[model samples]
Target: MVLTGWASMLAVFAVEFLSLLYLGTLQDEAVMGAVGFGSMTQFTITSVCIGVTVGGAALVSRALGAGNLLRARTLAGASLVLMAGAALGAAAVFLAAIAPFTAAIGLEPDVRAHLLSYVLITTPFAVVMGIGMMLSNLLRASGRGRQSMWVLLAGTATVAVLDPIVIFVLDAGMQGIAWAGGVGRLATVALGGWLVFGKHRLVDWPGRRALLADLAAIGKIALPAALTALATPAAVIFTVSTYATFGPSVMAGATVVDRVLQLAYSLYFVLPGAIGPILGQNLGAGQWDRVKQTVRLTSRWALLYGLGVATLLAVFAPRVADLFQVAGPGRDLIIFFCRYGSFAWALNSLFFVAIAVFNNLGYAAYSTMIGWLRATLGTLPFVWLGAHYGGAVGVLLGQTLGFALFSVIAIAVCSRVLRSPPTTDATARVA
Candidate 1:
């Protein structure tokens, strides 16, 4: 499971890093920033799908643990139905509102046009991602993590190969980048569908009543989880807006820093994902001690791994900065942010682990609160202060400090919650 989780994250890091690497080689920092905005536009919707992914995994794990395979299959089918419906709706809204949305965020005209093109090219197929999310989560929960990993890797590999051809050779520019990703996602949906529905036949269309019941079950868990997931993008929207105030170079630098962080902290982030099924099944089986042990051991591993990542980022800051071909203030800001924010990787790891535990244990609302705190209380004020006083560097400092503060608070809250008595089966059902 850990290997699969690691592979899944690695695929994303590879794709994004390659994209940024290619973009950087152009020596056009503004285009790089535009690319960043393109990514941010994509996240505006996919983050909402996190609820579906997390919910599907949690429910499926619990059902399987209780030997309710049939129920699990029904839930899987229902999730597909839900994802399709939601994806179509989201796509329509994004297509219609892209212009206004861009304006509301105060994007520069050139960047806004670039972002619009990217969103328009990719938004309609947003369901591909939601389907991929559902199928991958179901595969992981069913302990077919390796299979799921292969599906995503194949798709990401397709993107990696096509990215250069589409962007450089074909001269498609920013929009080409989105097309590359859409092709990759299309591949993921095809393969994932085969795995979930064709070869495995894991999903069976239950009657409408049964489907709706399962949808309700999924929604019960997914809504809060989705909100929790939504917090990051919402916060990113604010953070990016804050960075925009510093001008395009800073925005591009910050965008580069985000991609770097994703790469550096990929392993640490996977720890929480890898822990999800373990915690879910154990908690379902009433093995509280084992669940607690798993959290402890994996969290310790996350800390150690995070420290290693921090060390590498700090030590290799110059080399990493050079990879982006950024110069002037943009280059300096990227290096400074990487070194300064490296330690926050440890804090982020702790928070990820805690949130995973909370969601799997049916305290998703708690997870939501923690995420909100990290985004709002942890982020906004500090970012405001740092932007006001310290400029671009101060923004990084503020966000890092916010993570540091919330991580401790989240750890304490999760620890206390974990030690509390388990809920009764009836109470669990109501939740």
Candidate 2:
């Protein structure tokens, strides 16, 4: 499950890095900042979609473990509808607010315009991509991790093939990247829909009442899960906005480091999704010991992976900075993160693993609380002080300190939860 999830996430990251690399070659800091702003904004909007999927996956996996195929199918179908609706709603809200939001951020005119264009072209496709994500998560919950991986790979492959043609050959710039992303999402929906609806028959349309009930149940988890997902992006958006004050060079460098972090630490990002089903199914089967064991093992693996990746990143930090053609303060930011800030990911991995446990084992509200605390108390003050003291380098160091502190808190809370008696009624616990 981990391997497949890693591959799927790798493909997604590869396409993103490719886009960033192409933009870097243009030697345009505004474009780089625009991409960073646009992508993070889109991610913020889509976090709700992810939360819904996480909620649905937890329910579906539990149902399947209990041998309740009919319930699983209904939940899957209803959840997809719910996810699409949420995506559409989020996109609408984003489009309406983005203009004013960008203005408020005080971005350079060119960067602001590019950011708007990127979101405008790509926002409408959120529904398509949300559906694709729903299907992929459903596939994983149904014990078809390989098919889920393929669903993601399909989108990645489409983007890989079209990005160069659209961006370079057609000279579409930011608009080209948006168009390719839209097309890639379409490809994902195509493959994912077939797998979930046609081949596996994993989802079945539910009646109105059933749909409402399932939605309500899913929302019990999704609401908190959504908040949990939103916390990081919200912190990141703030960080980016803060970084912008330092000048476009710093913002551009921060963007490069952001992409490198996502690519290198893709495992941590994918770990929650990969472990969700394991934890959910075990919980459903009343296998408390297995659930506990899975969390322990996952935590260990996350730490090991983090340490190894950090070492590699530090070793090759300079080459990576050059690869993005980032120079000046931006280059310094990248190198600084590679050498010092990268170690923070080791702790962040533990926090993420704890999140999976909370989401899957019916303690989702814990995830929300921890996530917000990290985003607010753990992030804002530290980042402000870091920037105030160390400039851009301080910012990275501060964020790292925040992660380390929060990871310890998360692990403590997670351990307490595990020691408590297990609950079979995930929804009831949430209520």
Error of 1 at 326 (Å): 1.4
Query: At residue 133, what lDDT does model 1 achieve?
Result: 75
RMSD of each: 1.8, 1.4
Can you tell me which runs of candidate 1 are displaced by over 4 Å?
425-431
User: Which candidate should be chosen as best, given lDDT against the real structure?
Assistant: 2
TM-score of 2: 0.97
The digit string of per-residue lDDT tens for model 1 on 1-431 reads: 88788878888887988888887767776678877876765675776677777777787888888788998898788878877776676667667876887688787776776667767777876888888877877788888999889778867988999999977799877778788888998888889888988998889887988888888988887788778877877777777777877667887788789898888788765665577878878877778899889888877887898888887888889988888877776777888866868887567878888888887887888888989988899899998998899888888888888887888888888888778546785328412
Per TM-score, the best of the predicted structures is 2
TM-score for model 1?
0.95
TM-score of each model, paired residue for residue:
0.95, 0.97
Worst 10 residues of 1 by lDDT: 422-431
Model 2 clashing residue pairs (backbone): none
